[model samples]
Target chain A: MKLAYYPGCVSRSTGKEMDVSTRIVCAALGIALQELEDWNCCGATHVPSELVSVGLAARNLAQTDLPIMTSCSICYSNLRSAALTMEDPQVRAKVNAVLTKKYSGAQIRHALDVILEVLEKNDELITVPLKDLKVAPYYGCLLTRPRGGIDQPEFPTILEKLIKTLAAEPLDFRLKTFCCGGPIFMPQEQAAEDIAFLILKEAKKAGAEVIVTVCPLCHLMLDAKQKALEQRYGEKIGIPVLYVTQLVGIALGLNPDELGLEMNAVSPMPVVEKVYEKMAEEA
Target chain B: MAADEEFKQEVLRLAGPEVLTCIQCGTCSASCPTAHLMKPSIRRLVKHCLEGKKEEALRNETIWLCTSCQLCTVRCPRGIRPKAVVTALKELAEREKIKGKDQAYEELFQRQIKDYGRIAEILLSGEFMFVFPQGALQSMELGLEMAPKGKIKLAVEKIRGRDEVRRIMEELGKG
Candidate 1:
């Protein structure tokens, strides 16, 4: 399966490892990824003006005729939202007036969607299952939102199904689709930390050893800001955040380097080590 | 209540007429995770927008605080998207020159996109730090932590077709 991959800004920079693992997983699954020739930033969460956000996203959409696959959920949201926005005749005309080419509808798929579809097709490909690892699937806010969105916002089962397919225990946490306080992370540290704390606390209470996500922004909030979250809340909730593909890569017996496990802010080694130990014991 | 025709029409154009469907059920406030942190709360902001309190609605810090999470939008029984309304109000605020903390990041993002056609997180943060040293000092711990991992890039790599992006933006009258 060949898809036009859009690895948003985060995956290219701070979240490079996420991008790397996504590529590794896709290759292992025999999927060909053709990156957009020259994609720009999606204007992220805080676009200065509505036109700028729509224009930037439209420019990227114009680059590909194929369905767009994204590593970051925000990129998925922005691109998807932009494509949906262009459906309005007036908005389409207005946006086309500013662009050299007219933007049209493009199917936007998250990395998880691609992963799940692949897993469904080839269940026997999993040689090494992630045994005994309790995973909490964190949807953050963007992945499944803005009415008529890509997935079920209230109860997303895609990640849970993927975790179970990997033979890992998927914990049903209350905060699966909760806000990880992404936009406020930069401006309002306290508010961001508080929201992160709530997520971490709930995941820990649910006995999840690691939190897996598809959004780079959620990974940053839950993984990078964990130490700060612990300090602010004065509690040791040491759950590591891993990209969904990282967990899939591990299950497919891919090398740790290929999965970019070490690049994660909170080390996922402890969780990986436990999974390996459980596998050995079962053997 | 005097209706701010301009504000209401602009919001309706960008965000859709769903804003008028708000029944003031406070579901948005209840659904919002950061409503407590917001000054006027999202419900109040919607009310102010309806009442044509243009200056008050656009200038509020709450307008910029929205994470665009869209929880309020999904949870609202009226099918109104408060998140998009917030974005619409934010655009208005930016046009009116009502500066907020988020504007700093927005300006930095716009500049980076215009210059390179893509954002290098490392360079963007460095530029952000240079622009707001105080904020940098506060987030110094994260910088120190990520430094050892060699994650931060010291150089900027311009995208191949950056000129095309610039031309498009210029066509849009943004340049």
Candidate 2:
């Protein structure tokens, strides 16, 4: 299987590990991720706000003849929203008119939808049983919103299905679809931190050893900020945030480093160590 | 003053005709993760929109802080759609370039969206250093610590669809 992949800004920056692991795991599963050449950003949550047409126009033009895939939840949302809008006759005509007047045509796809489709096709790649692993799958805001598409808007089951396929137990957490305080981190650090704290706190309470996500922004806000949150809240909420690709890599028996597990602020080693121990005991 | 009134009405009108039914239940605020951090509640902001206070709403820092989480809409009894409301206000702000103090952050955020179809850790770290020279040292230390052992080669090498992805981004920019 092959996908035209779009690794958004976060994956290139602090979330490079996700990009690394995603490629490793995809290769192991015989899935090819073709990184989109000269791919522009999806405008995330902002472009869609300022100029919906321009934002969508930018993304729509970025898509080539192939279906585009992205790793960030925000990108997924923005890209998917653009694709949806473009498919509409009036919207498409208007957008295309704008595009023809502006530049050449471009097309893209929602990354999560593509990844989910790939997983569905190759369900057997999850050879390593993850029965002992209890994970909290977070679907942050973007993947499921604006009232449309493949995944449920309110509560999504795609990630849950993916986790179960890996043989891991998916914890039921209230904040699974909640915001990870992403775009707000800079302007409202306190609020972003508070939201992050709440999500981590709830995940911990629900017994999630690791919180898995598809969006790099969510991963950074939720996982990287734990220490600061602990300092402010005087509580040690240490649930590790794992990109969905990392978990898939582990299930394929790839090494932790290959999955970029080291980059997480809350170290995932303890959970990995426990998994290895369980494997040894079972052996 | 009429133009200002017209802009306010336009904002409310673009909000999809549901602006006036806001019951002030605070469900949107309660559900919003960012709301807990905002000085004025998201609920209050929606009320401001309903009241035709366009300038005040656009100037608020909270307008830019939303993550577009639909929790508020999901929880709203009156279907106020606080997230969408904030988004509309942000559009207005961007039009006037009335960026809050964190405008640079917003720009950096947009740059990330524009560069890679998704966010890349290495690139984001580099951007952090470029934007804030003081952050370079800290970013480097963090990068070294988070560097994926043995996987550095894979990242540096081009994957299959890279060229096409780049072309697509260029098209978007030109478009």
Candidate 3:
């Protein structure tokens, strides 16, 4: 499987580990990730004008003939929604007006789409079983939203299915599809942190050993700002947040360093060590 | 708040006529995470817009509080996109120059995105501090924590095709 990889802004900046692990895992799955040349921002929810956001996303879509894959849920949703928005002739014409090269509607898929396709075909790819690991599959807003989602929008079990593929237990997390409050982090600090706190507290209560986040911003909120969330909420909720690829990398027997597990703020190292211990004992 | 009176029609045009499809089920506000924190919840926002209550709708600060989760969009049995409706409200608010706490920050954010095509966390924070000093300071500690870990980028790389990016911004943002 080959794809045009558009590692969104956060992937390069705050979520570097996601980019790394995604590349590594794609390589392992014999999937080639062709990085989109001169890709700009996905025109995150912050973009001022709807037309500008569509045009910005249209630029990247027009750049690749091949199906584009992004690890960040924000990028995935923006790209997918842009492609959908272009279905309207008026909107398409308005969007195409700004494009140096007109957008012809490219196929946009999340990295999980390709990875899941490969994993579904060949279960042998998962070398380490991650047996008994209780993973709360965090979809965090975008991976499947706005329309034409990979799974059901309100209730998605695909992440849980992926967890089961890794021989791990998928916890019944009620807040799995809830917002990580990443977008409002700066403007609505207390609200964003309060929402993040809810997710962390729930994960801890549900006995989630680790949370596999679908979006980079989700990782930043749940993992990077975990200390701050703890400080603000006045509680010790320390469930490690890992990129979906990072968790998949773990089950593939990849090294913790290769997965950038240490870079995770909440310290996923203990979870890594536990996985390794289980693997060693199984051996 | 501007009492444009055309606010209802404008929102309908921007967000689609699905605004009229709302059954007032309250599912949207119920599903919304930050709805409780906002002055006018999602359901009420829809009601206010339909009722042509401009100030109660657009100036509510609820539109800005939206995380764009789309839970309201997906969960709406009437297929009304509360997220898109609220986003359209936000866009309309900015276009109308109706300012608020979050709206002011959004303008700064849009300016930064226009500048670099991508955000450099530290640099953006520097400009952001002036508008939102408290919010900036709150994230500063997180920045300090992540900087040593090589997570936060000190400088954001401008894309090679930034000229095209600028043209897109100039054209579409002119609206």
Candidate 4:
């Protein structure tokens, strides 16, 4: 019922819309999200050293004992890896040394895992099913990769299952667990663009009307960078990248405005309108 | 010469012995989405680390280019963590003052967090523009687009627990 929610930096700032939708969906599903008190950024891709990065993660972990739920893939990956690293006696000592609060063991759960569990338990929560919406579940690398990830790394289908539960079609995209060029977005802008272009191109080619993602960075790459990518390749890639929460919220019959659909750089309204049209026709 | 040896030991110490298990299988390189952008590739970086060529590995753009996606880590047959190896090299580069382009952004990131405890996107871009003027012109298109969308914040709002975060970071400095 209740979990410590760690929205991380992007979710608070650039990815605030995703966070908004996450809250709305969770409330609708009866999952109480208690924001971690005094939580800091999870040292995304910018920390100077492993020790400092892990220490920052540990500091956040030390704040709460409840299973930490993170929406950002970078935060999930970093927090999980830090918790795993603290298993080492040396790492534990080093991490413990650098903190006012010491982290012994913290279970990091991706927010998707939390929602998936809720959906599995109760399938009737889907009041407004997206029967005709075809969505590609883009996991990106961090959500389901690394050691002790939530699902199978190479071929994750948990999001696909969730999509099906919402009565939407989930495409078997080849790059489901692919990297979104998030880490290099700032420094190597062009490289990041090229990678984003490839992901958007592939998702479009796969007949994905909407590419749903859980990670803010991945969403930024696929959605916010679509215009730049289109200009670079001299082609149209109008596919809308959506947060999983936003899609789930739509299926749950929540208001589109509350879901932060407007916050998306490429408006998801076209896909949303199509879904609405299909639902009305069925009615 | 001894300094180079010292850097090698530091890398091994931070990254651990698992990095030494790399068999040059190229699974990491092949799996890496961004390996094409780098010269030596992640596999070669590990090889360089194993050979104790600390300077070469640290100086390579590959170290900074890693996105920490862990795709290579997941695909590596030998259970080696190529991402951690890159992190170690990045730390080594920071220590040795080799100064990769990524390091500049990393420094800016750290400074922003230390000062405000949270990143104010608008301020961050403004500061980034001042620091990397060439990039400012290039990224301006993206920045201009994000401003009206409510994605970029115009003001810096410090987190509620700045003192606590400062204390934790101070402890790290003492290390």
- How do the candidates rank by TM-score, highest first? 3, 4, 1, 2
Candidate 1 residue-wise lDDT, A160-253, digit = tens: 8889999999998899888888776766766777887899999999998899988887888888778877876789988889998898998888
> Alpha-carbon error at A154 in model 3, in Å?
1.2
Q: What residue runs in model 4 are displaced by over 4 Å at the alpha carbon?
A: B1-4, B173-175
Q: Write the per-residue lDDT of candidate 4 for residues A186-277, one digit (tens) a residue.
A: 77787787888888889988999999998988988888778877987898989988998999888888888999888898999998888888
Clashing pairs in 3: B1-B55
Error of 4 at B91 (Å): 0.8
> Which lDDT values do the candidates have, in the order given?
0.81, 0.67, 0.85, 0.81
User: Model 3: residues >4 Å from true position, as ranges?
Assistant: B1-4
Which portions of model 2 miss their true places by more than 4 Å?
A: A48-62, A88-90, A98-124, B1-4, B17-26, B74-81, B95-99, B107-175
| DockQ by candidate, in order | 0.55, 0.30, 0.69, 0.61
lDDT of 3 at A175: 93
lDDT of 2 by residue, A1-283 (tens): 6677777655655677788887787678676777766555556665534334344435445555555666766766666556655655654554454342232444454544555567678777665667669999898887777667547778789888888877789999888987887776544556677777889899989998899988877887777666667777899887888888888787778888788777677888898777777777888
Model 3 global lDDT (CA atoms, 0 to 1): 0.85
TM-score, A chain, model 1: 0.96
Any idea how many clashes model 2 has?
47
Total backbone collisions, model 3: 1
List fnat per candidate, in order. 0.53, 0.39, 0.67, 0.61
Fnat measured on candidate 3: 0.67
Model 2 per-residue lDDT tens digits across residues B91-174: 566667874445555556555544443444465446555655654654454445445433122243233443433444344333
User: For residues B52-124, could you state the per-residue lDDT of candidate 4 as single tens digits?
Assistant: 7776787777877788888888888887878878887776677668764578888788877787777666676
Badly placed stretches (over 4 Å) of model 1 are: B1-3, B167-175
